[model samples]
Target: MELQQLRYVVAVAETSNFTRAAERCQVVQSALSHQIASLERELGARLFERTSRRVWLTPAGEAFLPAARECLEAADRARAEVAAASGEVRGRLAVGAIPTVAAVDLPVVLKEFRRRHPRVHITLTSAGSDDLTEQVRKGGVDVAFLGLPTRVEPRAVQSRRLARGELVAVVSPDHHLTDAEMDLRSLQGEPFVDFRAGHAGRAQSDEAFAAAGVRRDVAFEVSSADFMADLVRQGLGVGMLPAAYAPRFHDLRIIRLRDAPERVEYLVWGAHPSPAATAFLELVDHGTGQARDRPDPDGPAG
Candidate 1:
């Protein structure tokens, strides 16, 4: 029988009167009675005994009442769960970030986002910019924070520049060059704690040095910005780092180099982002620059 028929049976069972049951159900008594009669006919069992003075339940009606009530309750719960899933803004979001950006920027943004949207689950992964870009392109992450000079062109993925940060040279406080801003050429023979070759920061560092006609003596290669900073602190060599991240270390001396290039960090995604991803992007937009640049899909960059 139909769900409404079971509802009518339950209403009548609860009220013990056809007229009151119909009123509770917002239907006429005759209509409610007809539906109950139809249900009884389908089941081939009489659900109610009628007397001149009152109406009473049959043995079958007693047995069916609990099951009918359970069915209605289950249906209600199913509807509620579906609505919660779709409308309450709950889901998992996977985000990737380059080591430097993750170290300096992501913590504040993620903390505020969690405060505002407590139901959304988040997973974070830190990698070099090149690796993070591929993760976004291949759908391993819903969104990513990356620096410029993307390994794969922007056309294959969507990206927006979030912040323009100046790159600076980080050195131990006791180093000779730590006291003053130096020219890019002055770093030619200085020992350097370099980022691994494939990192975007390393690429930018290499480009700036080559353009300025400076050749660096590599002292060590490390994959993490934190590790590079620690190495610099131990007097291994001067390392290049973003200004925002440089302030985090108290022992390191941060100095700006003349004609040093600025780096742009981007929020990259594959195609359109999901709802939760879009919300997180909005938070990023408010924190940094607006998302104005839409990469041209079939252009030379792809």
Candidate 2:
């Protein structure tokens, strides 16, 4: 009913413990519980099923959660819109990226955004490209940076290609097979350390190798770029990474591939973005000169 009641419900649902939820909302346990009880009486259904050990959302609560969240988001967006009308960008900006984000200097970009819009709060998260894409589409993330094979582009979101580069082999200095450049077949016998199966990072290599009819052994499948580099540097297996991203590990050696897979980095956002998101996007456009005039169409790669 009331916005404050919805906020309390959301807080309780997220924490799953009345006391912890009260602490998070900066309210006493008794007050929070009383408010939830009052709401339950008004709705004529229980929102949560509570036990001595844990609390969980009942069916009614599950149905109410989404609408409650949408209401909260709408309220926030209204406030943001009013602020923007006054030429002020004051809202939360959630940015997501892959672990090996190299197309843009994120630190410098975020620093500049903060300097210009001091009122906007920025949060950065790193995940697989597909996950970031979904988060953006679902409104969990305001903006995202993702990399996929050149043959494919992000689908179902507003996106622009920032840069394209080829994948290169990463090896240890002590490895015996030394070459300036080689094809995928040459590394067929070498064990590999790669991103997890189905991940955008791994998909490029997988599709390329499958197209070339090359079968390789993947010894380590990891989520962290640094860990993958560590494994390759120890000669556990060879790794494939974007040419731009591989240079960050100075201790590792980079070998160009004659038939390397190409990757395209993109900036993606939802159809309706917040004012803070709009401000950050304009700054990005000004810096890169890749304005929003040309937006990639929404669909999966053929």
Among these predicted structures, which one has the highest lDDT?
Answer: 2
Angstrom error of the Cα, residue 280, model 2: value is: 1.4
Instruction: Point out where model 2 deviates above 4 Å.
Output: 288-302
What lDDT does candidate 2 reach at residue 2?
A: 86
> lDDT score, residue 262, model 1?
62
TM-score of every candidate: 0.65, 0.92
Top TM-score prediction, candidate number: 2
Model 2 alpha-carbon miss at residue 115, Å = 2.2
Give one digit per residue, the lDDT tens place, for model 1 in 129-188. Answer: 778878887666888887764233344788775556567899998888844687788888
Q: What is candidate 2's lDDT per residue for 1-302, written digit by digit as tens?
A: 78888999999999999999999999999999999999999999999999999999999999999999999989988999999999899978999989877767778889889998898889999999899999999999999989898777788999877767788999998987789798999998899999999899899999999989999999899999899999998999999988878888998889999989877788899999899999988887776433222133442221
The TM-score of candidate 2 is: 0.92
lDDT of 1 at 126: 87
* Whole-model alpha-carbon lDDT for candidate 1: 0.76
